[model samples]
Target: MDESWASTIAQVVSQEYPAAMHHVQHGPGHADPRELHPAFWGSYDWHSCVHMLCSAVKLHGRDSDLGLSALLDQRLTPYNIAAEADYLREHPLYERPYGWAWAMQLVKVCRDTRWEDALAPLEAQLEHNIAAWLRTQQWPVRHGVHSNSALALLLIFDASPRMRPLVERTALDWFGAERAYPHEWEVSGHDFVSNGLAEAALMRRVLPESEFDAWLQDFFAPEAYTFYTAPIQVNDPEDGQQAHLIGLMLTRAWLLREIGKPDGTQQLIDAAAAHLTGTNFMATHWLITYALLAEDALGN
Candidate 1:
């Protein structure tokens, strides 16, 4: 990997923070900064802006942008958490499956920043929303694109001993039905379904070993790889962090390493790293994090 990868990420993040914040302060909710030209609504939101900033921290291992960091740190308070919960409580897309995922992400960010009290209402809201989804009269569970993503994070990151059973049960319930394969192919014009499945593999890695291992094998088998749709080119304009296809691939690669399958793991990582580099997608911060983790995992 080129040494400049980390710096590239930092530069993009450094540019994005101010731009995102400016839009958040002035633009409508759900607006994304990338869509600012035609005044497209819902391009980004506070949640997305915050997620990007958090991604920066994850990449750089430092909160170098104190102003942006301070803004997010303060915004994730109990009051703000309650407000977000209440807002999501009323909106289905924002409420159940979707809300659960973003809430989990937010919780992780808060935890990273030591915002302990913020988790209380956030957890309550997540449980309430998830329970409501469970009780919905629908026969076969139909999780929306965004909601499943959120719920998957909960499965991956739920660290509470008391919550393990609940988490597993939820996972089983969500994945219970034989998925006919995800149908949504484009989000921002990137291959959304396969990317989601890839992320699911990582999420399950921390689940019950037997179950997770089985699912991982199914997702990573040669048949699946050959049959799977490749994401649109990195610069396809519609593609954003879908470029972090590397994150998904690396996450899967690490799972393989955990299972003593290092050969294919290296191959996947190299492929992902190359894709990210050719398209200028993976940033420096992420490359560094990925490299360090991969090296540490293999003890190389």
Candidate 2:
């Protein structure tokens, strides 16, 4: 793996985040995760953009640079400042006192910088979010991916000492449950890639690595992809349209890479890049992640 690949993507993702946030302003001064540039609107849609930005910045190695630290400071504050006053009291439908992006950005930033000072307030919000998650018995929480993904981060965060056990228990419960709400829509009878990746990462963090390894094989089985509905053929020449396919393919590809299967990983990356290139949905976050992964595959 090219170590610099992570940094390159980090820079590209960082460059776009501020502009993407600018387009989605929701409240008096808040940005909506929905509205992006016209052409890139479908390409880098709101949720995808936010997810990609969070994921890319979370890439582990690049967080220590003073330059990157300053960039994060620029985007993190005012990006969230607009909602500070009303965050808990009168936030939007999906907006929360502790949003998935907010938590993700904070935790990831904390991974490298003593920016521990910057994250002090965010730690309180994460604590609140944990309580909010535990208090509910609802299968799929109010927000779409936000709740599950945010919960996953509670454990992923290196700083959350108290949260480790709770996240472990919650993840095990989700995995052991007889039925799930299905995060994957393309698959008629399956969950989405976003959900798969979230749960997979959670399992890896909470369980023994060997057990996690077994689960990865079962989830990425070829038969499972065939049964999947929407993203069955991500790069089907017939329709030649469908950006969401990248999410499913890349998730599986990344899973392979995690286990050190470079061959399988590169195949999926190639397929996803073919679909994304020159597509209108270029602005989506999945594409960004895909691009970074592809760059890595190319030894960039």
Candidate 3:
């Protein structure tokens, strides 16, 4: 990641916490978002806050001189983390599979450090919640957004090796037989993740190399190659909904790289970068998470 990007991510993660109450306020005590989700009360929403925090930690490593260390040290305290877990406990289904998955990814990157211990309480809660939910989560959400099951499984597969069996079984059960996904008209108006490519990314992790290759060959029509291999154009930059298209570019680049097709990856990333030209909170708060994924995949 660039030095400027490190600064931008740190700033957004530290500030821009959800300005208003988003979740259902069950009681009178939890009024402020900061009070509601102490450790993860920033970046517009819980899930975005969690992943942006992860991006900050990943970019600014152990001895990084950036303000991220101090910010993390302060927010990732035991008290704050415990409050976050408590929030999850109270609202059992809050953030559901999407937020839970990103929270695990945050913990995955923070492992082997003090951040891990700070997040231990939340991690335990997530493990318990996800285990119970997976058994009942029989249907796969094929949307190109937060509810999508493929992206959640991909994150779980990447973050927690202990959950590999569940992840594999869930993936194969849901998407193993995928063939003939109509690629010409796959994405929607407001999408941050490509549903088809997201499934491909997860399948690459769960299936063997030979099997994945064969599955890849059969998953999409020839039109998908052309559609996915190019960058998406954003007509409006300031609109948050349109920003979802910008985020999709970075996500597709990373997922493509993950599935072993690096062609046009840089073009996709660069095109996304060109539109990230302003300080619009609409795109700033969560875009870095996708940007980090793109950078990491390209780097590897």
Clashing pairs in 3: none
lDDT of 1 by residue, 1-300 (tens): 223444443344434332322332344566444333111112133333333444434443343433344444544456666665664455544533433554555455455555657666766666666556655534332232333442343433443334445555655565533343442432333222234343454345445777666666554554444333332334432244554454444544543444445565666566556543433323332333344445545852
Name model 2 segments beyond 4 Å from true: 1-71, 78-102, 114-116, 140-161, 177-201, 209-241, 256-263, 274-286, 290-300
Best by TM-score: 3
Tens digits of per-residue lDDT for model 3, 15-109: 74445335886567646677777888767788888888887788767348766888778778999989888888878788888999999998999
**Cα-based TM-score, every candidate:** 0.55, 0.58, 0.94
Of candidates 3 and 1, the better by lDDT: 3
Q: Provide the clash count, candidate 3.
A: 0
Name the better of 1 and 2 by TM-score: 2
lDDT of 2: 0.44
- Report residue 126 deviation for candidate 3 (angstroms): 0.5
lDDT string for model 2 (157-259, tens) is 4346666676567667756432333334433222224555445545666667787667666655544333332224544332313444554566556543444
What order do candidates take by lDDT, descending?
Answer: 3, 2, 1
